[model samples]
Target: MASIDLYQIPVKEVHGVKGKKPEELLTLGIASVGDLLDYYPFRYEDYTLRDLTEAKDGDKITVQATVVGVPLVQMYGRVKSRLTCKMMADPLFITAVWFNRHFLKDQLKAGTDIVLTGKWDQKRLHLTVSESEFPGKGTSQIGTLQPVYSVTGALTQKWMRQTLKQALTQYGGLIPEVLPQELLAKYDLMPRKQAVALLHMPGSMEEGQRARKRMVFEELFLFQLKMQAYRALNHDRADGVAHPLDMPLVRAFVRALPFTLTESQKNVLAEILHDLQQPFSMNRLLQGDVGAGKTVVAASALYAVVKAGYQGALMVPTEILAEQHKRSLERLFESYGIQVALLTGSLTDRQRRDVLGALQMGMIDVVVGTHALIQEDVFFRKLGLVVTDEQHRFGVNQRSVLRRKGLNPDVLTMTATPIPRTLAITAFGDMDVSTLNELPKGRKPIKTYAVTHDMLDRVLGFIRREVAEGRQAYVICPLIEESEKLDVQNAIDVHAQMQFAFPDYKVGLLHGRMTPAEKDEVMREFSANRVQVLVSTTVIEVGVDVPNATLMIIYDAHRFGLSQLHQLRGRVGRGEHQSYCVLIADPKNEVGKQRMKAMTDTNDGFEIARRDLELRGPGDFFGTKQSGLPDFRIADMVTDFEVMERARDDAAELVRRPDFWTAAGYTLLREFLQREHITDSELLD
Candidate 1:
């Protein structure tokens, strides 16, 4: 490769000019041609112009003709400035215009040969300039392919254009190729530097797309390697929780239940049993849709631990959940004389010490709590089974550390979010997964219906009917207050109106702003049937399973994720009685109406999650943040499920190669190591 003149560098290099010093370019970290190539165009700088007669509305292009007349300033309204210039371009006359760019006031002067690139606002027959620069010559022979660089605060387009122009100064020479030889040939991938350069300054759209394909492949490859390493290091022998799957305790606990287990529950529980029998540690995810009877399945595992003479540790996200779980288990254990203790940060020092002492003494058969269960002072004498409620709510490391307290405790993680099957495989490759897809037997399916705010009166009438029938209700509002800053609904106003509407009955309010004690009191009131109506936020989603609460009315239901709405609906229907879920939505917004309709259509969480993913598109399903899952910027777990499956298989096979960690994958390793900000990497380090 030989160097060439800086002036002839591609348009992108000039479009990517950085800061004042060349050293400042060092921090921008243009370490590899791949790095530079991966940066995408913010928007198109389409200089694709049309002839005067062919120019349509909003056409961005450039034309060079002698400015036959002076540029005139035309201002309209309180804020409108337009620079229009009439020029002769042969048989047709062209009018070039610039908007609001007052600097162009002098630049588009009379008799100046100005080449303007702008959109043709056709209604006014004006070529409105988005940007303008002299092509250094009359547009008589202008270059057709122009580069548009993504601009940043420290770097102006002109500066970037200049700097990138400087880097590509040696236009005739190619940069060093970094991909391994065999892969380069096998995949038919272009030389690394050439691919990067092409992406930044492609001759055509097809070439740019091809470049994108290669870069996306590389990113996913590195991510695959990282996931592979994580699985290997975490799942190897001397690696798993050796479970004493004591069937006697499990059978006794199951037989004691008043209700029959749903086949789905039995099957998932059996899967957990099988995993316990394996030599490898039982790192399993129990994905149950909202109201899928996850608690009962967990109780079976806890019983097994106790019968096996080992302790079980169940951790929850909130103190209320911890206490609720403890109360449920305590009731279950009381039948068999088994012991369960609850611990939380709110516990008095003496009470905590007593719980900790009992735990270390092996006196506590099973322990349930918030983070207090994982404290250094809280040690289990022979802890073996660990269950995390709402696993997604806990950080990966936090979950791992809690598990670490025991002797390779078999970990049972449960989530209300029913992930699609494909994502479950890739994101949870190291963990065995069991899904409880059915509600426990005798549990009535909640009849769901969608209603607009206009139908609120009828919905309220139905609620009144339920109340008259001696049933309780939950009126869920999306927000806590009418934030002057946001347009969200607040629970305060809703509770006030319901209080007025249901003057014959008691109404209670609960929100995040309320203290734990306050929320607990409200839930208790509703649970005991003291409050006929509880108007609250999502706080009610995880409230105790009240058998008599038959109505769940959600306002602005579209504001919630489908999974969440399902959880809210699950709050009711725990009883033998038929339940109703009323979704109050805006009828005008067809999209919102459709989303609410879909929720009313099915109670299956997996189906809802799939539909929600489809409705929200994969790229934005997680709401624009890199999720807590694997680092796949290019391969979205939600969108690129097919690609992820292929990549996962390919990666697994790649690891089988004797020389996988050899020089062949050095660049891939370096790429994985670049993500150093990771906090919880025990799973996919």
Candidate 2:
């Protein structure tokens, strides 16, 4: 084969053949042959098809065979589809049967020597191998460098594979190495061209593995550098060390606690206090699992801010939560005579003005509300600390907006989603993380059960009993429609059915389409127990936690993630009564059963998180880099646990060296920060 200029090759010509444009390819981070080579396959296909004599059920095999006879389409009574084809592999006779690929007749000609690789089930062999091309040497030669291109709708594997083969051969040689020699040797990464060439056309899985290692390291190393730079930018500009807190109030609030705080929570709270005590602004993340008492920790933090003779503001996702926090805090800090006010979107114009006025005038000690609290007019006379609830929902930009409202207010974010430590470090590495692993004493372990649709009546009867005893219930549905493919009952159907079945009881409904006011109204009725049963969709996935709602019935429980299920369960058991979480599901598959069993077996959010990651997936594990999550191309947070530790060590060493900043090899690190839009200017406290 002759060499060619990769950059000179008309990108439009190849994309024209693929029926896509260079821009679409750019979405996959491809612009030229060099880009194409950098793009590696997530997984590889093994074309080692078996011999016809060794065919077995459930085996994915490929074989070189001949359609010695004429190919005919069988018309099943209705069109009589053909299910089998007679083929010969020298000494053996084999059957090639496929479904839904009715066009194979035009592709596979009689006496045509071809290859078939697919699964064998029952007495039938399904074929994923539908490749057929006229050989230049009349089927006498087979290509050794088999290419597998990433595919999509209307584009077949055969077409993509062919396109990649031509493009790589004609345009792959011109790409140059971007990494410095010392860096390449230091990391032991394979050459760029070799990795790309072998990735698209590899002889074995080992070759594919080598290609992946090189690409993965490049992606992760760049990600780490970006995060470190962003953090440093923030640290450079620090402000606000207002002494806002009276120990008397904090001690009184803690003493009022019904149970002891976990040592982990205590340790984390201390860390936060220390940060608050520093002259530098505090930007910390408090992450824990469901039922880990993050609220109490938040309340304790709020007390510290108030005791320091400055106002504290807590922002939650919903008015119901904000009101709950207001009431809870007012009750806990009641001893210190701390005035707490609740501000919500639902408040009347006059009420909002009064609250905002009080806040600015320093009449309010702690202000709690939804996003409405972050409005520009909502000024704080002495806003020393800001605590955001469900931190993930409020992004870094949103939280920063809230902090910007004050003179460098300390920011403390709290979440019940206990991500794996590695993922936490990767995603939130810039923030100090504190884990609340232990639950407060007297917190009853929730009884979780997995039941099927057949057990609905018994479950409803139990719920009715609980309701009759003055306890409320939360019935969570996956959607609002009846899907034949799914067994779960939706909100529209569940609410109507429950109302008809229990006419004496009031049933309220909530869904995503409802206006915020409508949702708040319905939630208000349910929280007050005016609605005995609240049948809703995942809209109730978070917020509006009713302690009185002691029973949680989640239909199609297997459909929701474990962390989500745990959070929904957390809505209950907030009261003194024992709570039960019924996972209305069938053990449909191994994954479904495992998820259901995990929910039943444990209530630990961190453990549930690890299992969820293990169960959820690895590739595209965190949302994507586009979603502002730390990208882990090959480093599985679960599998590459030690790699992260080592990488962190390496990064620390690189930064500490005097000559590290001047090294030309760090160009990629500098460029990555600029590309990610993370700059020193963003660090303005």
Candidate 3:
């Protein structure tokens, strides 16, 4: 028989597998042998040999013991079962229990030899285990490190292990090495096949670590190559506008500002200006904390583009934000003879037609809108620059559609979410990034407080006082409705409580479930001082800028990520009034306490983002898909920063080689990138 290629074979085709179906395995993302092989373990268990008598509570151990009695199975909850039994090794007696695993009754018979691996709870006098099976025939392999995979649906860990073992045994010879031998030697890495095998069944923890390191490098290397390829494609042509630097209109707009720009703003403005003058399109990312005056820097660049006799479009994620930007830009550009128009979904058909006609006639110098700008009928007379606020909310395809409006328009994307420096390079390697690190003069920092449930009444009283002083406040809840599983506060319940507590003041409710028109109306009411208090979720975390909203109270704040909490706190402290952010929660653990402390310690978004990455790795930072990053199985952007950097450098060098197109592993790397949709450009656009 011809040797089977694991990548080309479906997993269900293997013999002796009867119960598992294609759809069941697909739930765990294992459709083929390749998917199964790439399905790395989320964690490893040290099943190494250890004395059962010497084990402490919560210590994982593997002990060889013979069953001493028949197992007794008992029903617990509606969907739970417990099986208990006694196992012995001479003087050592272990009471082991398995939950919801009724199949063990047949395999675990009296006088049967077995190796059990699980944690021991001495107080309960039971060994809480998930795995128990007949001892395999191998002295050295009796207790070795093992892989614990995350299986779903009808697929159990045993099924995954058995399937993978069969594939490795039957088709291990066909596992090709994608990494070059010289690169492997330089990194002191093992062969690809050996690494995959050792990762599944390692003799020691050291061997597992080595195998994991090689896999991490492979993931990072592939990602770096894709990013470099995208960058080269974006900058390869000089088909974009080179807006002139010296313009009277831009100088006038800057001079007309009420306050002087900060040094950081000036430096970033210079950087953007340089990119605007490049022959190729400008793909730059402007990052800063809340209230860091990134808007002004973007406005400066847009002003320059308009002065160069080209139209510009600023796309915000929300209609209210688009309207706000329109107002701000109008005030700044009115005296400079620039016409700014707002185009949002909320606009009437006639209104949209008027703006679209004006844009086609070159009457509108700048257009600000939400996703409505990317509509088919919307066209720019000469779109030289494209600015997007909160870039994460917009995908690469949406940005590309807008970019196609002009002949390779220079793109400037802005975000208030301050990503860590290392991750920024990884997530946005194709774009030149400039950060505004300082707040403009006269902007006051928000005072943050971490409070427990005991202080809730006091915090409510303070918010009442702030409202009485002619200021508005925001009350944030994590959930829209009460969840059976989560103990967090809901917006509806909190909104009712606020209304009942303060019957004299008008309280408004706003959440993600509300329509855009409804959200816009509520925000307008709050901004116009009609609503004394706004009860909402994190929907207001992004672009609602109310100068009078000086007080913020977040219930069950520990449920939010540190960076998101920072953004929530930023909704306030926008005006001359001294603002306060009260975070109410009794943290359940040290990580929660640390997140609360970080919020209270500093108002810096970047610092909070870094700490968030440390606490919850890169996966939860912005979610793997939304961040346009590969869902790395083992590589942590925090702990593996050095490894990622090395891989990135090597990938860059390899891509620049003269023979890169025909190099070894080039096809495999390209195919992997294509499979992942990394080169689609929709992610980076």
Candidate 4:
């Protein structure tokens, strides 16, 4: 047989994949032979032979036995039946029962030798057969490890296994090796062909683990290589603007601030200043807790850019956040003779045109807006700096488009949601990272507690007392309106309840369904203490600051992730007065309970983020689909963290070589990257 390109051959062309099987494979995302080969099993079933006498109750084991008597088939309902047979081992007799498998009666006869795999019930000396194989049958999977795949659309495990086996046997050798020989030898990695085969048909669990390690390393290595390549290209570009560091101006601006800068914030600002002075454009991510004072560091950077005779742009996710930042920045830089303007969709046509004209003509030193900053008509005279707040909220292309407004502008991305170190390196590998873990001085830790529905009255009383003391409070719900499928409190119902409970105080409602203007009005009232209790959904999860709000009561807290719960908790602790967070939930599962416990245990956002990653996995940690996190076929961000670090280091070293693309050992890697269209443009996007 002629060797074929696995990427070109369709699943239908593979042997034994006939009829609807081709369509079934398509539904599983197996378009070509290559995708089929990459569709690895999620788990494996160990069917190694075990002694029947030594098997304990509830232990899944495989045992060889002989049928001692005729099998009896008992019919129950229309489609339900039971097949029972007695099997005798060397010195033990066990009864095997197969529910809904009545056809097996024809296969089991007196004195027939069979191998059965299932849980052992020692009390009754019985085995519930999950799989059975006859010794002399046409094809037996008795004493071997079996691969269990995730199948759908009328696909069975047996059919999937058979088709994969045939495909591997035919095209396994033709699968090209993308990694260099030196790496393979240095890491002691299994060959590509051998690893692929072993993943599907490993001799033992150890072999399976080894195969998984090789694939994990490959996936992470390639991903990091692309990241390093982007970094290299950015550093080597000649269009990068080397912004002059005006230390005197920066010091004067810092001194004008009302509060002293924390040591952690100072160190992070130093790092950003250093990056700005370099010839290369600064592509950095600044991550901190909700009240960690990241805004000060960003303000300093923007001040440096404006003093250097260039413009800066600050982009945020929501209009409310944009308005807040603009007010804050205006207050910070007004003394330095720098002008800041706001641009958003809410602006009238005349207002938008005036701001655009001012930006294009070098009148405005800094512009703050939402997605409006990326509009085609929005141009900067010399866009020296681009700062995006809540970086995960914006898509990759959205940020990239804003960056393109300037000629290799120094970009600074900010996020209050602390990311795990492992995720930071993998997701933002192309950018330098600076973390601020310490909160500012005079900031007290928020007291947290978890309660059930029975404590609702006490919680409301606590909030009422706090509001009576001239402090504001927040009441959060999981849903904006009542959900038929989910049994959780909604914002509207809670708002009405709170109003009735505290008739003397004002209660406001907020959710995502409200217009931007309505939300702004509610938040404005809450910030001014007019609305003492604000009943809201998770829309208040990010960048809503009201230092007077000292109490937060979250309903159905189990529905929120740990990180999200942490963010909501941060809304209160901003004031000097002691703050509190009350989580009202009755979790039914261990994970939900753990999430609630993690929130009440500590106020550290990084620790909460780490726990959330472990509990929810990477995909749901922060919505990886929209966060620019790569999808790996086998690599897990939590379990394979060490392997990811190794891959990152290796890729960094490889990309630093001067002749990386032209080297002899890198030919295959280069070709692979080209074949997959992993170029600078695509990687950046």
Candidate 5:
């Protein structure tokens, strides 16, 4: 028989496979043998032989024992069967139970030696197993470290292991090696064929770890290759207009500010100014914590662009944020003889047309808006700069479309969500990064507290008292509307209850479901102090800054990530009055408790972000798609930082080689990247 090409053979053709029909395989996304190979185990079970008599509670163990008596088989409803048997090990008796294995009754005979692997319950003196096999049978997977595949529908672990074993037996030798042999030798990495075989069936623990490291390096290396490719492609892609540094607008704007700019802010502004003067387009990310005065720095850049006879656009994530920027820019520029316009979805036809006309006619020097600014009709006459606030909220496509409006206008992306330095570099290697590490002086930190659900009433009473003292308060709920799937407090329900609880105070509701106009109006009321208590969702997390709001209560706080909780807390403590954040939650798990504790322990946004990254993996910390990072199968952004660094350096060097794309090993690597949809040309385009 011809050896099957694992990449081309369908999974349904594998021998000794049952329970997985062709259509059923499609449900699990297993179209070919290659898909099965890529379907890595989420976790592994250590089935190394262990002493049954010394087992502890909740121990996953494997043992070899002889059956003491005939297995007692009991049938459940319809097609299910349960088998129970007792085993003897010198001085102790152990009971073993298997579920839904009716065939085991005929296979497991008295006095037969068998190996059982399962979770042992000490109190019940029984080993609970959904899998079992007799020793010396054709099955070679028992008593060894085994992979537990994530199954769907009627698929079982036994069937998947058997089918995958068949594939490995037939075609594991044909698994292509992508990394150059010299590179693998330099890193002391296992060969790709050995690693693939070991990942599915490792002979020992050390071998498995070595194989895993090789796989991780390959994944991170591919990601860095894509990033470096984009960076190289964009080297001279845009013929950016170099604005003159002799413009006096930036100096005058800084002098007119109410407070002295922090040293970090000044340094970041200098970096941005240098970028603005470059002949090539600027792709930069400006990251700062809350109250770091990033807006003022951006305003300075906008002022410089306007003074150089060019228009600028600032796109924010929310309508309220756009309004806030518009008002701030108007106050700053109107006094300095620069025109500013606001464009948002909530604007009427005439209002939008007027703003568009001003922008097209070079009358509006700076326009602040949300996604509406990226619409087809919104054109700029002399657009020189484009700024996006809360950058992670927008995707690469959105930001790229906005930049396309202007002929290679300098791009400045700002985010209050402070990512760790290493992750920022890995995720955004195509862009230059600047960080504002210092907050403006005199800004007080929000005092944070994590309280149980029973103390919620006291927290509410405190909010009531704070509002009564002529200070407004914010109540944040995790959900906008009641969700049957997720049982948590919602903004609408909390808004209704607050109205009844505090009859005299004006409580307004704000959630993502509301239109842009409604959200903006509610935010306007809250900012003006007309709404004594604003019950809302995370919509107010970023840019809704009300100085008078002195208290923030996050209901069901455990449902939120630590960084999100920190952002919510930042909404308070902007004013002179002492501010407080009450996290009302009864955490059901240790991770939830750790998140709550992390929030109350420190007010530093970066520290909170680091802790959040540790608690939740990179995928959940800031979402993979939002961060523009690929979903790596084995590499972790946290634990494998050193590996990623090495891989990044290697990739950076590899891409510079003349034959990198066509070399023998690299040709296979390129094909893998193409299959994974990480092609350089696709992303660079």
Candidate 6:
């Protein structure tokens, strides 16, 4: 059968999947036989038989024994029951108990031999049975590694295992191998079919590990292949804009800045300038820690592009950020004759029309806006460059749409959220990365502390002292309003409490629930020192620059990821004065405590990001779905990073081959990509 036909076989057609079982399987994303085959277990349970004498308390083991008595079913509270049976394993007799499994009473007869797997209590000679099997019954799960899947309603692990076994038996042979034979031998990888079989039914833990390694490599390799293809296609495109390299003009503008640019910033700016001079469009990611002066580097790039007789568009995620960038860029380029305009959703209809007209007529040299810049009516006459701020906040399609406004315009994406090395190479693998590691001179590191709720009064007192000395402070809460489910403090209540605590100081509130105008007003007041203390939510987590703000108090700080806490801390320390961040949290778990320790230990965003990835995993680190990261079923972004790196290297070499896609050895890969709809255009998208 053809691979496509085999993949299209419905789950209902499988031998064991009947009735609502197909629907249940579908809920787990298994609609077809191919999906079922690819539905790998998230983990496995070991049922390898062990000697009863060697077992210790709380040890998960499987013991083979002969039933000495009939199982007894005892009714418990409110529809609950327990089934117990006495069994003899050589010199010792043990009792096995199953909760809510009363049906097992009829199955286990006296003198019947069976194998039971569960957690053992040695003193009581008891096994709390999770699984059991009769010795001769063909359905025995004993002495085998049991695959445990993540299932949905009515989809039990036993049923899933059986259905997967049936699917593999019927169609596993038809599953094609995408990796070439030479590559497999070089990596010492198992055959594709063998790996799949081992994953579902591994003989031992080592076998399972070997199988997992192969799958991880394959997933990473294919992902890197797609990224490489996108990069190649982007480079080969005919409509790329090769902007003029006017370094003399750009350097003069840089020289006129009030402060000297750090060596790291200069190096990164040089990299972006070089990309602008290329014949192909620039697709680059500019990453830096908070207050690392990414905006200045971006400004230089924008100056270079506008000087070359082209318009530029800067897209940010929030309206407040858009406005801030506009004002700063305008101030930066006032003497350089570059016109910067702000276009955001909050603009009046007449103001929006004027900005749109100016952009279309090339009157605006650089336009800063939120998603409003990507609206259908917005037009750019000679747009040569596109810069996206906090790039991860926007979706891939949003970025693509803004890029589409110009004719293959050079794209530069900037993010303050420092991405880890593993994610940088995989998630942003298609783009050239530039990092700014050094902060501007004389900038003091923010002092950080983790304290319990009892320290709240002291923290507030410290903030009052800072405010009394003419510095602003920020109080952040987890929620905008009270939530019945969440016990964390809310911005509204915090704002009131802050006002009451500091009666003489101005207390302002800002949250996501506020309209853009309301947020901008509160921010304006805070920026100008009219508001001494600002009580807000994470809405201020990004791009809120208050030079005079020297203190930040985060309530329930453990509720946030390390990177987020780091970002909030960044709001302060922007000026020459000393800054401090107080984390008011009573963490209940080791991971939470570790996060607090990591925050108090280092001020480095990169280090914090790495730790965040380890603690929260990739999904919660940056929200993989929104961050353009693929959801790998078996490959973990943390533990399997080395394998990913190897796969990336191999993929780069493979893509460089002259006859990569057309080669006979790559026939299966080509077909797989096609089947998955991974076209060159979609790869970049």
- Full-model lDDT, candidate 2: 0.73
lDDT accuracy of residue 176 in candidate 3: 79
| Model 4, CA-based lDDT | 0.88
- How displaced is residue 25 in candidate 4, in Å? 5.2
- Which stretches of candidate 4 lie above 4 Å from their native place? 1-36, 50-79, 84-95, 106-113, 118-128, 150-156, 174-177, 180-182, 659-663, 676-683
Per-candidate RMSD vs. true structure? Answer: 5.7, 5.1, 4.6, 3.3, 4.0, 3.1
TM-score, prediction 4: 0.91
Scored against the true structure, residue 491 in model 3 reaches a CA lDDT of 98
Off by over 4 Å in 5: 1-39, 53-56, 89-91, 102-110, 150-177, 180-186, 247-249, 480-487, 496-504, 513-515, 623-627, 653-685
RMSD of 6: 3.1
Where is model 6 more than 4 Å wrong at Cα?
A: 1-5, 8-33, 51-60, 64-73, 77-79, 84-95, 103-114, 120-126, 134-139, 151-156, 166-176, 659-662, 673-683
Candidate 3 lDDT over 1-685, as tens digits, reads 0112665788776554556567877887777777777888777777776776677878877777899988988987776899888988546777888999866888778899987877888676578876776766444335666578997777777667777788788767678787766689998999888988888877788898899999889878877887776675556567778777675656677777878999998889888988898888998899999989988888889889988889999999988788889999888777778999999988898998999999999999999999999999998889999999998788778988999999999999999999866677777668878888888888888999999999878988998899889999999999999999998889999999999989999999999999889998999899999999999998898867899999989999999999889998999989999999999988999999999999989988889998998999877887766667656766878888888788878887877776666765566766665665665644454
Name the weakest run of 10 consecutive residues (lDDT summed) in model 3.
Answer: 1-10
What TM-score, to 2 decimals, does candidate 3 have?
Answer: 0.84
Candidate 3: list runs displaced more than 4 Å.
Answer: 1-36, 52-56, 65-93, 98-114, 129-141, 150-176, 180-182, 247-256, 467-470, 479-525, 528-532, 587-594, 614-620, 623-626, 633-639, 657-685
Ranked candidates (TM-score, high to low): 6, 4, 5, 3, 2, 1
TM-score of 5: 0.88
Which residue pairs collide in model 5, if any?
none
> Per-residue lDDT of 1-685 in model 1, one digit per residue for the tens?
1111222232334334434443444355443333343444543454544465666667666666567777788777767887777876444567776677655666655567656666666676566666666656544324445566655446556555445544555342455444456656766777766666666667676777676666666656555655665565455566565565767667767877877788998898888887776656788889887778898889888887687788888998887788789989988778777789988988789998899999999999999988877777778999888999876567666887898897677889888878887666655556667888777667777899987778888988999999999999999988898988756567999998999999999999989998877877887787899999999889767646788999999998888877678879988888878999999877466667768877878888888888878767544544333335555534456656665665566666666666756654554443443343211345441
- Write down the lDDT of every candidate, Cα atoms only: 0.71, 0.73, 0.84, 0.88, 0.83, 0.88
Q: In candidate 6, which residue pairs clash?
A: none
Give the lDDT of residue 587 in candidate 1: 49
RMSD of 5: 4.0
Over 1-685, each residue of candidate 4 has an lDDT whose tens digit, in order, gives 0113687799887899888888888988888898899899989898988997788889999999999978998999888998989999778988998889998898898898999988899999989988888898687777678899999968999888988999998888788787778789999999888889999999899999999988888888888877776676556665678888788988887888889999999999989988888887788999999899998899999998899899999999899889899999998887778999999999989999999999999999999999999989999999999999998888888999998999989999999889976689788767888999798999999999999999999998899889989999999999988899999999989989999999999999999989999999999999999899999998888888899999999999999989899999989988889999999999999998999889988889999988988998888876766787878888898888888888888888987888787887677666555654554445465
Task: Write the residue-wise lDDT of candidate 2 on 1-685 in tens digits.
Answer: 0112454454555544545656566666566664554455556556664565576667666677888656656765665465456778656666777655556787667878777666655355344444433344353224343545565556566655666766677666655555456657887889866876777788777787787676666566555655566655566455667464566656666777877778887788778877887777887878886667787788888888877778888999876678778887887777777899989888999999999999999999999999998787888898888999887677567787889878888888887777777677776767767888777777788899999999999998999899999998889999888889876688999998899878989999988888778887998898888998999887776656687889999998988877788888888887889999999987668888998989988888878888887887533344443224544545566666666655665665565565656676666555545556765445422
Instruction: Give per-model TM-scores.
Output: 0.81, 0.82, 0.84, 0.91, 0.88, 0.91
